[model samples]
Target: MESMNIPMRDILQRILKRRKIRPRPGLNYNLEKQEEPGVSIDLDATLASMDTMEFSLVRENSTRRHHNEGSEDEVSTMADSLTSHQYKSYIVSMVHRLRANTDVQLGVSGEKVEVDPVGSKGTKFFKQRAMTYDADNIASCEVLEEKSTGKSVFRITYLISHDYKHSDFEADSEVCNEIVSKINNILELRLSPARKDYVATRAAKHLRKRDSLRDSFRLSKYTDN
Candidate 1:
């Protein structure tokens, strides 16, 4: 039995050496060659390359952050320069004060004022049409009283010699005063140095964009890769 077992073991060893068994498919197997001997590593060079890559990533992130901050500032500045338009409507005249014109409606927004003629449909063609004016164009706004009826009138005077006098408000005295105050506030805000600077900056930006529209695409050609 021992002699037979020894011969069987020798035969098995020879067969294994001659033909190595292939690994089964769908199995985790490492078939790569072993690492070669005498493969030296330069510690300093490896560290230097890693540091260079890290520095490059930091610089790129910093540049991107700066560009994003600049874009946000530009957007905020542009938004500040724009005017608000939350309009407040007021009944200028509760009753008709003029024979030719009927009641009038006043609308006041951030920096704009609109006056509309409210009359019967039959008289609409002959009545004065609605008009809108900027607060910058208006020189003064005041409440005047008619001598005959003692009713409060909202009057807007332009920078020129023009004056817009609408119908009187027999009951809405406080509303007329509030409208005048709002218009005055808007005018004051427009005259501020910051507001003027923003307006000038926006206008310059528009002009620059317009001038560069044709040549903006050519910038990439001159830029370094």
Candidate 2:
């Protein structure tokens, strides 16, 4: 009997990422900066937001206790494990979601081991494992040494440059904006914070009732006051 051959889906394939482009999204991003002369941009990049990281705060007690020879792990292992095993998983998951089917590019670079897709130098050091999600991305990353074994902190930076045309500039800006907006949306769902209603219709509705000549009414007391 001939067996049927149904292809099994690949796990890594499911998590693959792609780069998206607008071709002429909006503004050109590579023009030289107006504020600094001869200091030009390579591409239109935006600093998404800075996320401060506490790589690892070592505990003296742990360090002293582990000082014996042939210790199971060092005080810094806590951070290293956290960053490499746990945090790296989160970052990978995020990149997958954002890049899957969305046309997003990613790359990794350091010591010429890997290359960045964007090909820019603005960076952040994280107690992270080196990763190259895409081939042509810019932004070299490094996993620097931290001081704790329980918590590995990482720094992730978004890079930008000025050599981009207005169209690419706007597209990159829009992408950054979209990411920020998504975060804001998630925050709103949780705290439900109050915001000033700039386009409120309640006041306008009240004014409409006041100005309306369509609902004129007469009141009668008939001296029964």
Candidate 3:
């Protein structure tokens, strides 16, 4: 018996027919070139263009990262400055709040002074309002007593935008004097050299007083013996 050679397509068609899958009867199963030839491509040029695009993308990403980093640093620096300013304001307000005088309702702090006056209707209807003055800008503080009324007036001389300005508050003699003294202390401590000298002088005076007391105590013990 002679063996017969069968096409792969015909075998597949027969298998499909057995499985009840019918192919189009008029369809050609032969493998042949039917369309026009494809155009040739330049592999090297294509690769070079892709490399250039990739390098540009990398450079753009790096530049964006650098810009973001710089913006973050600027924002952080601004936040730090804002925090410092807030802390200074808090310290100023706290100092004024604690030691306010009862009669005048005036308070002095390390950085500023505040005065609260009662309205005609009193504090129940009208909330207490405060006026503030900067200690650093103050050039002078004075208290003057009126002969006719026997009331004391407190005057503050300060600078605003390099121009001299003054604010006046009315209080009794004791309150005015206390406010003036506190303001003067702030002004005197403003200069670093003056503050250092004052501290050194105070320390020397305290040491001398302590030594004198010790000597007196020793002499008293000897006399008792």
Which candidate comes out best when scored by TM-score? 1
Better of 2 and 3 by lDDT: 3
Per residue, candidate 3 scores C-alpha lDDT tens digits across 49-160 of 3221111111111222333565556444322321221112111111223344233345566656666554332345434356676656667777754445555676777667
**Could you tell me how far off, in angstroms, the CA of residue 100 lies in candidate 1 after the best superposition?**
4.2
Q: Model 2: residues >4 Å from true position, as ranges?
A: 1-63, 66-156, 162-225
lDDT of 2 by residue, 1-225 (tens): 001121111111111211121224442122222223243333223212112111122222232222344332432332222122111111111122222211213222211112123323233632223333221121222222233443222222222242111101112333333323332222222222121121133467777887663344322343344
Which of 1 and 3 is the better model by lDDT?
Answer: 1
TM-score of 1: 0.38
lDDT of 2: 0.24
How many clashes (backbone N, Cα, C below 3 Å) per candidate? 0, 41, 0
**Candidate 1 vs 3: which has more TM-score:** 1
Kindly indicate the candidate among 1 and 2 with the higher TM-score.
1
Which residue segments of model 1 deviate by more than 4 Å?
Answer: 1-85, 94-101, 119-125, 146-151, 160-171, 192-225
- Tens digit of per-residue lDDT, candidate 1, span 87-200: 678766533544533466778776667778776433544555677766666655667664445446666655333433333343256666667766655654456343354456
Give the top-scoring candidate (lDDT): 1
